[model samples]
Target: MDYYAPESLSEALDILGRGGVTPLSGGTDFYPALTPGGPRQSLLDITRIAALHGISRQAGGWRIGAATTWSEIARAELPPAFDGLRAAAREVGARQIQNVGTVGGNICNASPAADGVPPLLTLDAEVEIAAAGGTRRMALSGFVTGVRQVALKPGEMVVALHLPDPPETAVGAFRKLGSRAYLVISIAMVAMVLRRDGAGRVDHARIAVGACSPVAQRLGALETALIGARPEEVRVTMANLGALQPIDDVRGSAAYRLDAVREVIARMLREAGDG
Candidate 1:
């Protein structure tokens, strides 16, 4: 196998445009996917590219580089509204994986159980992609097409993720129901952001469920139901998550995942209310 570590974003895109080059960020997902006879030939390492290596505040919100690791996100002192992301970051894997698994890699991998997607979707995040000619930004929800599938073009590479400013009254939480406590793929996961009025009624709510669908989806119906609802009322709204399409997989059955969604949503709402 051959390796090329680009020092700039343009160089990386140029390599991608040539085709047959696997773009590597942190290599957490790529290395594992490659076995004795796997389809990996050449690696285009982008971690050395300075333009794709940090988090910064941008025009509309924040821009997180593709190479930023989960460990970096977990350690950052973000606003309370980003608590859900921090929590998900901490649960991505053991300490070692967190230190090496980049947020871009997680999104690019496009797994149904990806821990980062739920929180990013709840934040209304956008993904920035660059190819040989230009760049484009697409909503995270639209960027992911299905399980292990994304809308990125053949020559395009995810450069950064943009997140809008969070509401001041916002409080967020995340919950994952897996078979084991640590280092396990989630059977179901929930990421929620709630903004309450001064009178304690929910002014705005964003809820997303993962590992239960083709792609992690925001519970728009549930979010709408929670509007103007009190904390106790929020729990009641969570009981109706059966509308989501969950599949029976090796990790869990469809019925169990549906039930787990409800339970995780309730737990997230309860935690958000406590803070």
Candidate 2:
């Protein structure tokens, strides 16, 4: 099979239009999932593309290039509003994996346990897509359709994630529960972004959970309920998780995952609301 390392996006897009290759970013997922010489699909190694790597300021918030590694994200000089994401970044894997795993790869892989999704969802991130045609954007929520699935069409790839400015009053927190303390797949995870009013009540809340559903989802009901709630009083019930459907897996049972996330929310609410 052919292998390519294009340094420019234009060259990569040209290669994509030819249609017989798979784009490989970071390879944390791609290399592991590769079949042993079966199919022999061409490989487009996009890690060298300069345009696809870095984080920059946008008009209102930030744009994180798709190839940006978890290490870079963890080290980025971001505000407190992004603390949850940075915390999640550090937990993507061990230090070595964090250095190699791309945020774009995590998103495109669409793993139900991906640690990056919930935090980014809390940030209200949108993905930028590049194709032979042009560039377009989609909400992070709409981009991941299911387990190991995404909205990419043939000849298209994720370019960057655009995060809108978080509320000035917002503070964020993240928590992950795994079979082991570190370097293990998630049993459950939570991310919270909360903005407090001057009266010490919740003005806004965005909560997301992973590993408890086919895709991580923001808790709209919980967010709505937290409005006007004092930080210590933010509460969650099973009703808040009606949208999620966790399965019984090696890490934990469906019931266990639900209970774990409920406790995660209860804990994160106090931490995140302190901002």
Candidate 3:
């Protein structure tokens, strides 16, 4: 297999513009998808790009470079609003996967069960994509079109996951239910971010669920319901979960997923605090 590592985004984009090159970062997903003697792809490794390797504040929010690993994210001194993301980072895989898996890779892989998605959605994240022509940005909600599908066009690669600044008082929580405690895919997962005024009323709320839909989805109904309501008064009705399209598999039944989500949501609200 041919391999080329570029030291700059422009250089990488130039190579990608020529076409027929597979982008590689941590390869946590790429390598696993390959079989012995399977078809080989010409790889353009972007991990060497200096610009694509840090987490920093920009445009009043935060910029997490495409090559930044989960370990880096989990260790970064970010605000309380990012707690759900850090929690998701810690649960991405085992310690080794956490050490090597990149958020860019996770989003690009576009797994329905990707732990990174729900938290990012709660953060109102945007994806920055780079190409020889320049760059473009899109909401994380629209970037992952479906299971294993992303909106990236030919010659474009994800450059970073950009998070918009959230309410200073907003705090986040993440919960995933699996048959086992560690190293197991989630049967259902929920992430929530809430900001309450001094009067102890929820003014802003964002809730996202994964493993229960083709893509992790924000619970707009639930979010709207929480607004102006005290945390203890918050309720997740079946109508609130109507947006998720969970399918029955080995993890759990559809009814079970909905039931679990309600429990998870209640716990998450409590963790974020209640009136």
Residues 1-275, candidate 3, lDDT per residue (tens digit)?
Answer: 78999898888999999999999999988987899989879999999998889999988899999999999999999988899999999998899998989999999999999999999999999999988888999999999999999999999999998998999988888898999877989999999889998888899898999999999999999999889888777776899898999999988998899999988898777666642
TM-scores for all candidates? 0.95, 0.97, 0.97
Per-candidate clash tally: 0, 0, 0
Model 3 spans > 4 angstroms off: none
lDDT of 1 by residue, 239-258 (tens): 45744788898899998888
Model 2 score (lDDT): 0.90
CA deviation > 4 Å runs, candidate 2: 273-275
Per-residue CA lDDT of model 2 for 145-234, tens digit only, reads 999999999889999999999999688889999988779899999998888888888887888999999999998998888898886786
* lDDT of candidates 1 onward, in order: 0.87, 0.90, 0.91
What TM-score does prediction 3 earn?
0.97
RMSD of each: 1.6, 1.2, 1.2
Q: Which residue pairs overlap in candidate 2's backbone? A: none
